[model samples]
Target: MILKKGQLSDAILILLILLFLFTPLGFYAKVQLMRLFSFAPSIEKQETSQKLTDYNWQLVDVEGNQSNFSINRGEVIIINHWATWCPPCIAEMPSLVALHEDYGEKVRFIFLANDDSEKVRSYLNKKDYAIPVFFENTQTPTALKASSLPTTYILDKKGNIVLKEIGAADWNAKAVKDLLDTLLVEH
Candidate 1:
C-alpha cells in the first residue's frame, strides 16, 4: 500500500511512542526525564521542621558491623533511603554521588537500602561509587522512616530535619551545597 506523506509521519511518531512506552528505552527515558526536571530539595522552616531528637535506631554497615545512630549526633547528616530496582533512586544516584564526593568529609551520609538486594552491591561496584551504604536491621526512627524509595532527609547538627525530599532531586545542585554550608556553621 502506498503511504501518504502525513500518514507516514504519524505512523513513525506512533511507533516511536510505542517503543518508548514498552522497551528498555522506556526506563532510560524516564531516568532522563527525571534528571531534566529534578531540582534541589526544599528546606523546612525551623518552626515547621521535625527534629531527630531520639537517636534510638540501628544500622548495619555493608560489612555487617552494627552501629548506633547516636554516633552521628552533633553532626550534619544526609540520610537517603533507596533501592536498586527503584527508577527514581537510580536517577538521583549520580547527583548524590557527586555531592558525597565533595562533602563526604563534612557531612555524614547514610544511604539506607530498604532491602538487602544483591543487585545493590553490584550496581555500586559497577559504578565505582564510594558513597556509604547501610542497612536498617531494626526499626527505623520515626522521623526517618521513608514512606517511599529515594526519600532523603538532611539533618542539621542539632537534629533538626532541614530537608525531606521524597523523589528524584539534584543533590549536587548549588542550592543543596549552600544549605550544607549553612548547616556546617549551625550549632
Candidate 2:
C-alpha cells in the first residue's frame, strides 16, 4: 500500500495525539508501581521531636484568659483561632468539644474566637460547647495573627508551635489526636 506524504503526516499526528492523551495513565501507573517508596516517620519518633516551639504565639486559655507564652514555658497548648461564621470551624466543633472533654486538663486547649465577645457569648449560648472560647486583642499582624478563619496552632509544652493548619480540619482524626497526645506527653 502506497501512502502520500500528507496521509503519513496525518497518521503520525493522530498517533501522537493519542499517545499524549494516554501518557498520563502511564505516569499514574508508575506512581502506583513505586508506592513502596513512600516513607513516613513512626509515631514515637514524630511525637518526641515535634517542634511546637517555633512560632511565638500569645497565650489564650479555655477560660477566656489571655497571657503571653514565655519561650520554653507553657507546653502542649492547642490554640484554635476561629470565628463564629466559619463553616469549617463550626463543623469541627464536635471534635473540639470532644478534645476538651478528653484532654482538656491533660493539655491546654485554647479556643480563641476571633470575633466580638458578645457574638461569641451568643453563639455559645445556643450550643453547649464546653470549650472555653476567648477573644484575642492582638492586632492582625501581631504575635498571634488570627487573620483567617479556622487557623489552628499547636504549641508545645515549651511554648513553641509544633504545627499550624490554616483551615477546618478533623480535630478528632487519629493523626491529630496522636500528635496532640504526643505533645501532651512531652509536657
Candidate 3:
C-alpha cells in the first residue's frame, strides 16, 4: 500500500520506539533510572584473592563502646559500607538483618555508616533493625572502598576478601548461607 509521507514518518517513529523499548538498551536505561532515584540494583556477586590491609579503623557500638577492627581479623567478617541517604543501602538492610539473626554468633557483622552516630542510630531505631550499627571513627582504607554504596565484603578467617558485592544483595540467599557454612567450618 502507498502511504502518505506524514503517515510513513509516524510508522517509523513507532518502530524505533518499540525497538528501544524491547532491547537490552531499555533494560540498561531502566537500571540507570533506578540508580538515579536511589533504588537498589540486583545482586552482583564478585570475589577477589587480595588480602585485607590492616587499617587503624575504629568502630563504636550503639552504647558508645569502641573496638578496633584488627581484633576481628582471625574470624569470619562481613563488613558493609552504607549511608542513611543511600536508597540502595536502605534497601538491602532487611536482608542483612535477617542474615544477622541467623549467623550473628558465628560471623562478625560490621555495618559502617557514612553518617554520624546519631543519624545512624535514628535510622536504625526508626526501622527497628537489630543488626549492629557503627560509624567508622578513622580513615577508611582505599582497598576497602568498593566504589559503590551498599558495598559488602565477606572476609575469610585469614582476613582475605573472598566475596565482594558492590550493590544490594539477598543476604538470605542459599548461596550466601552455604558460603558462610563453609567458612564457619574452616576455623
Candidate 4:
C-alpha cells in the first residue's frame, strides 16, 4: 500500500526507537555479548618475572572494617572491580561465585565494588553471593582503577598481575582453574 510522507517518517522513527531499546547501547551490553559467546576468561598472561605494584590499596568491608590487599600475601589474588548497575558485572558474577567455591580456600577473591556498601550488600544479599565484597574506602590507586566495568586482575603469590581482563568472562572455566592451580603451586 502507498504511504504518505509524514506516515513514512513516523514509521522510521518508531523503528529506530525500538532498535535503540533492544540493542547494546553502552560498553556493558557489548561486554555481555562477548562473554555469552566465549565462556573462558580472556586472559592476557603477563611475564611472571615482572613485579606488580604494591597492594596498599585500601578497601572497606560491608561491616566498615578497613583492610588492604597486602594482608592476603602468599596467595593467589583475584580482584574484580565491578558495580551493581553494570550489566556486564552482573552477568559474570555467577562464574565468579563458582570460581570462589572451587578455589576460595586457595585463592583470595576480593570483589571491589565501585558502588556504596549498602547497594553492594543489598545486591549480594539478594543474589546470595558469598564472595567477599568490599567498597573503596580511599582513593583507588591508578593501577587498580578499572578502565571499564567488570575488570578483573589476577595476581600470583608474588603480587604480579598475571592476568588483566577488561571485560566480563567465565571465571569458572577450566583454563581459569588451571591457571589458579598453577599459581597455587608456584606459591
- Please report, in order, the local distance difference test score of every candidate based on alpha carbons: 0.88, 0.62, 0.78, 0.81
Error of 4 at 91 (Å): 1.0
Candidate 4 structure quality by residue, lDDT tens digits, 1-187: 9989999999999887776556656454555675676468655565665455666777889888899867987778898999987777888888999999988988898899888778888988998888898887777666667889989988888877788887778889989988888889994
Q: Tell me how far the alpha carbon of residue 130 in candidate 2 is from the true structure, in angstroms, after superposition.
A: 1.4
| Top model number, TM-score | 1
TM-score attained by model 4: 0.80
Best by lDDT: 1
- Ranking of all candidate structures by their lDDT, best first: 1, 4, 3, 2
- Model 3, range 60-140, lDDT digits (tens) per residue? 887788888888878899999988766667667777888899999999999988877788889888988888777766776
Candidate 4, residue 113: Cα displacement in angstroms equals 0.2
Select the stronger candidate by lDDT from 3 and 4. Answer: 4
lDDT of 2 by residue, 130-176 (tens): 67676654432243456686777666667555676666555666777
Q: Whose lDDT is higher: candidate 2's or candidate 3's?
A: 3
Candidate 3 achieves a global lDDT of 0.78
Considering TM-score, which of the candidate structures 3 and 4 is the better prediction for this target?
4
Clashing pairs in 1: none
TM-score of every candidate relative to the true structure: 0.86, 0.61, 0.72, 0.80
Which regions of candidate 1 deviate over 4 angstroms?
1-23, 44-46
The residue-by-residue lDDT of candidate 1 on 37-99, one tens digit each, is 988887545563588988978888877889988999999999999987677998999999999
Candidate 4 residue 82 Cα shift, in angstroms, is 0.3
- In model 4, which runs have C-alpha deviations exceeding 4 angstroms? 1-35, 44-50
